[model samples]
Target: MADASAGRAGAAEEAGPSIRTLLLLAIPALLIGIASAVVLWLLDLVSGWLESAIWDGLPHAIGITSDNPWWILVVLTFTGFAVGLVVWLVPGHGGPDSATTGLSSPPPPIGTLPSIGIVVLISLAGGVSLGPENPIIAINGALAVAAFARFATKIPPLLIITLATSGTIGALFGTPVAAALVLTGTVAAVRNGGSLWDKLFLPVAAAAAGAETMHLLGGQTIAFHLPPYGTPNPIDFLTGLLVAAFSAGIGILAAFLFPYLHAGFHALRHPVLLTTAGGLLLGLLGIVGGPITLFKGLEQTGELLAHPGDYSAGMLAVFVIVKVVALLVAASSGFRGGRVFPAVFIGVAIGLLGHAVIPGIPLGLAVACGALGIVLVETRDGWIALFLGVALTGDLTLLSTLCVIVLPVWLLVTKAPHFEIEPKHGLARPPTALA
Candidate 1:
């Protein structure tokens, strides 16, 4: 009698996963959020350690922190060589091939984990001009899928993807709003034809979760404290219009240059050679650009926006031109990164040019406002543009100033077809891509 009962239970268990199986797999969504925050925190921590090693131990190294210009050519060439060698020798030499290939249909492939780790550690450690967030998203998403693979039931992949993505989104930005907007837009862009309402759900939760997580971890929450209701000065509005259009033009040109430069690098077919060359090129640019344009634009943006008094009009204009060029080169040369910081840097330079004419606005505040205003025109996401620009300067009182300039600038950029280029990797071939 006992034997018979045991046999029946075994049969049911083998039949299929219970509904609880899905719940168990999906519940890790919160963990994913925590994990995402942890990774960024660690990235920050690790970067500090490695920077000390390079600066103290490798003094002869050009631009220990800045991408040194005098030796930029050398650094770039060596980086290129190293990149090529790694591709030839490493387990996942091909990487994700996202440049010409387009976004991976999946956020990341399980097989590329080893290479992803290598690229991230080295890029961050070497003081390469890049952001960790892109690879962070890809790696986290890959890990999420691998964990969920053990489930026996037919769990929807989309739900799992959304959950894992939200986790990182919430963690990294500290404000779910920015992370949700960015990640959700990316997911939607890659996944064809998803409805508006469907896309909104994950981000909304992630955004809320991000804020809560920030509070939990004792991080600052960002917001706008506006000036009283009234139209901005006519001069401010006109200046914003000119600056917005100018910076956006830089962005459009940068986008156009990416593919060509990426293709040029691919012709080498050697990751080591490619990355080394990129590194050296960055070093040289740093020397010439005075280290202002080196590395990812995060810390640099803060300094420039905070102390606009340091730069002359000629220097600001030069900074904008060189920084844009260097970003195109680094990304195109097979170096992994994000453009948010770089974009903000360009906008700040534009702002400085304006302040050259009207110095009363406080160089820091002027540069900060203009940076946000231009990024709004370039990216066309008013919230993010505002968030990045204002958030960088540690000020929100200027958001009203942002409103005066960003909208009109965005409007002008909208009519230009160059704003949205067709995806390089071919569009979905079969109608059933979601499958």
Candidate 2:
């Protein structure tokens, strides 16, 4: 018994790093955070430039106006061809189909980073209904790991991954606490004996540095400008619950359809044919939904909210359908990106529709519930979903309501299929993927 105790103690001591070592490593972690933020900024700049040129400038240069539906179709179809060419011919197959992977999944080889970046940039610029979060994280993670291995061999690969992910998350949401909230569940699930907060210390430090750097460099926030939800009435709670539940149900339905869409797209068995078809479909959806349903939805979200009165419930419903289908197409068709931002847009539309129909519920609360439901369904992480709900509306008061609202929604989606793709190895049965 004494020997076992001694062995366990030794193992614990070895597993935990000393404060001095951690503090010493903080410098590199900070540098990594700064670098991650810079990479995101560069991606944003380039994507914005390309999106403007390809989606707007080129068409205008040819005398096409924004109202012309055929122009959007032509541009998106061409985008499909371009991305297909890159994915088919480029090495690393454009860095794995994102629909099949998690945000923190192992990155591809460092040599594949450039190709992945190019592909992601093309998707982002081409008005695909996906965000840059996943690919950017993978790109920064791979580069950070390689860079650290050269000079900081003592640092564990796991720690490097955590720091890079934290930094990228901070940049993505424009706040360190965003990273903290997103990772809290992951850190808590670790079996190592220690305070969860202690495990989070280093990663939080990196996130803080990353978030601050982005802020200093003019990082934008996704906060919606809306009137605050006044005193919470009992009826508001029921409305909130209903809104979240309905949105979650919609998201789950989409989740179930995800794998089939993925399989059908891959049925082409060639990247060129698969991605080009996906692009053409996306273009058709865009033509049906118009310009608002295109893009990653960050800027489009604001545009939608800017004049909520401009759109009817039917129009908002169309937005929801088009964006959801576009997101699925983009993800399944081998585009490199994340679903969070597009989900946000869809949630916003859901919230607006809820408010329009109900008329008694607060807009802010409706939006929060909408975001809460969809994000929870997509991420399967309660903390992230709640945070997104409150964060998007810039209302901390909504947290308590969301806390209660996420319960039933969670129950509904707990055993449902995840929003990820099936693995290639076929060894591990994905949580609820298609056979």
lDDT of 1 by residue, 332-429 (tens): 77765455556677777777787786634444446655666556543556667766656655555556777666776677556553322244565432
Residues 7-66 of candidate 2: C-alpha lDDT, one tens digit per residue: 998788647657787688788778888999999989998998998888778878989886
TM-score leader = 2
TM-score of 2: 0.94
Cα TM-score per model: 0.75, 0.94
Residue 4's lDDT within candidate 2 is: 100
What global local distance difference test value does model 2 have? 0.85
Write down the RMSD of all candidates, one decimal each. Answer: 8.9, 3.4
* Candidate 2 steric clashes: 0
Q: Write down the lDDT of every candidate, Cα atoms only.
A: 0.59, 0.85
